[model samples]
Structures are given as C-alpha cells and as structure tokens.
Target: MAASQAVQAKLSFLFKAANTQFASCPELSNFYLHQFQKTADHANVPLADAVQRLCCARCGALFVAGINCKVRINSIDASKRRKTPGRCRNRVRITCHACRHPTVTNGSTTTLLKAVASPGLSVSVAPPVDVPTGKKTKKKKLDLQAMLNQKKAPSPSSSSFGLDDFLSSL
Candidate 1:
C-alpha cells in the first residue's frame, strides 16, 4: 500500500515539474509529462490520472498560462443574474492549443454557490437554464423604455405546466 502511494506521489511531482517547465522547454517537459502519463496509466493511479486530465491527453501539454493553453474569466453579478441581463453565473473558458478547442468550466462564484446549496447546507442556488454559450447567439438589444411599456399578463390560478400540475397534485 505504501509503495503504491509513494509511486503516486512521485508521479504528481513529475507532473508539477513538467507543468512549470513546459513553457520554457516543451520537449523536456513533455518527456517527463509523458513518462508520468505512462506510469499513471500502467498503475491506474487516481491522483495522477486526475492530474493527467488537466493536460491535453494527446499533447501532454500543461494547461498553464499563455503557454499551451489559456483561460478566460467570465463573471456575472448576483444583482443582474436572476433574470433579464442579470442572471448571475461565472465561467472559466479553457482553450487547448493541441486540441484547438475551448472548454467552459465553473468559476469561483458557481463553486461557492454549489458548496452552499448542497443538501448538507440547504442553501438554494438558482442557475439560469437556457443561456447559450455558442458564438452564433446574437446579442439582444435592450430598450428600457420599450420594456417598461410592455403589459404584464395576469397570472392563471392553476399551473400551466404539466410537470408542475403533476407535482402540485402530489
């Protein structure tokens, strides 16, 4: 058991060293990173496996700053986050040079909200369900005057959704 743990720790060290050195000497860093990957795969070490996921599996490049990857911060504030333009959400966009792909991840605020809202804490977090992250989405023009002039429809006594009706019956 101890021997396996030591091997896992050594692999983690190699991963960290490779990450730091990747920007300066990609070839050497890749050598070490690849070594760690191969070892982790053979041993099926969970810690090293998780670390490997942070790198481009194909290129063995570390997801470090302007090196082989880039992360962009997108933050949405709480006041403006519930509806309208204000639905609060935070995202981190990760782009890998090897894959030529961008992946979005939850940012600090989303993580904090998750921590608070987990069943143990019982805090409620309402995240917007349909906001699109695709580049093709056209930005809607906001006209405050037109919005203020719109009429408010009266609420129905019964739920309009079949799912809601089913839950209500229960």
Candidate 2:
C-alpha cells in the first residue's frame, strides 16, 4: 500500500527535530524519535532507509557515531573464514550505547565509501543512460494506457466444460 503524504511530512519533521536537538538535549531528541517511530507505526507507514539506520530500534534513540552508538566493521570469525575463505566478508556493526543492542549489516563497497566520506553527507547516484549497442540504439518506452485497456484472456480452467464431460471422455 502507498504511504500517506501527510504522515510522511510529519515523520520528516519529527526526525529533523530529533536530529537538531540531539546535541543540546538528548532526552528531547529521544522523545522526538520515539514519537516519530510511534507515528509511523500508527499510520502503518514505513520509515526511509536513512532514517531507519540512524534510529536505534531498541531504545528509540538517535545513533550518532562515537556519541550514542559505536560503528565498526567486524571481520568474519577465523574458523568460519577458514571453512569458506573466498565467500567470507566483513560486516558493518552498529552498537547502541543506550540499549546495548548491536545491529549487523552487510559491509558493501558503497556503505564503506559513505562511512569514510563524511558524516551527515548525502550520496546520490545519477540515473543510468541507455548506451547504444549493435542490437538496439534507443530504449523502448511502454504504452501504459494501451496495456491497461487490453483484454485479458480467460484461464483454461474457466472454460465452459463440465466434470461429467471429462469423466465420459476418460
């Protein structure tokens, strides 16, 4: 289901307020964050990925690296690595100081890049361009209206054939 725009706006405001008050008043920031989570849950709307990563799922506290939470890249265990050398990879772990909950996520290249770049920095990727290949020079656009207006074929099971006819044929 689609999210309500009004609820989305409210969530944005709450997150911003929590972020702004985090340094000066941590309690107030936590309160705002708690409310933000509650509002999203009440409205049955999903939080944005950025916001979800920033907030502590256990305590509803804002996670500022080195402040409220500790962020690190955890290497695979020696035994596990030995069992599967090539498949083993590091994982990004964020531990909440307030709740002592550790959240582990994949240590992808893009995630490492973002962590090393800067704090509170937004990363945006440009839309992919259709490159000219020998087979196709241009991208084909779908006609949504025509597709919607097309008549759908009935299923074979929906045909006007009785069970008695099948038994007789058998």
Best by lDDT: 2
Per-prediction TM-score to the true structure, in the order listed: 0.45, 0.56
Off by over 4 Å in 2: 77-88, 109-170
Residue-level lDDT tens digits of model 1 in 35-148:
887777777665543464477666666677686788888876666556523233876777888776676655555556666677866765598688765543533333444465
How many clashing residue pairs appear in each of the predictions shown? 5, 0
Return the lDDT, model 1, position 169: 92
Residues 50-98, model 2: lDDT tens digits: 7788888878899889988999998877677557534446778899999
TM-score of 2: 0.56
- lDDT (Cα, 0-100) at 27 in candidate 1: 76
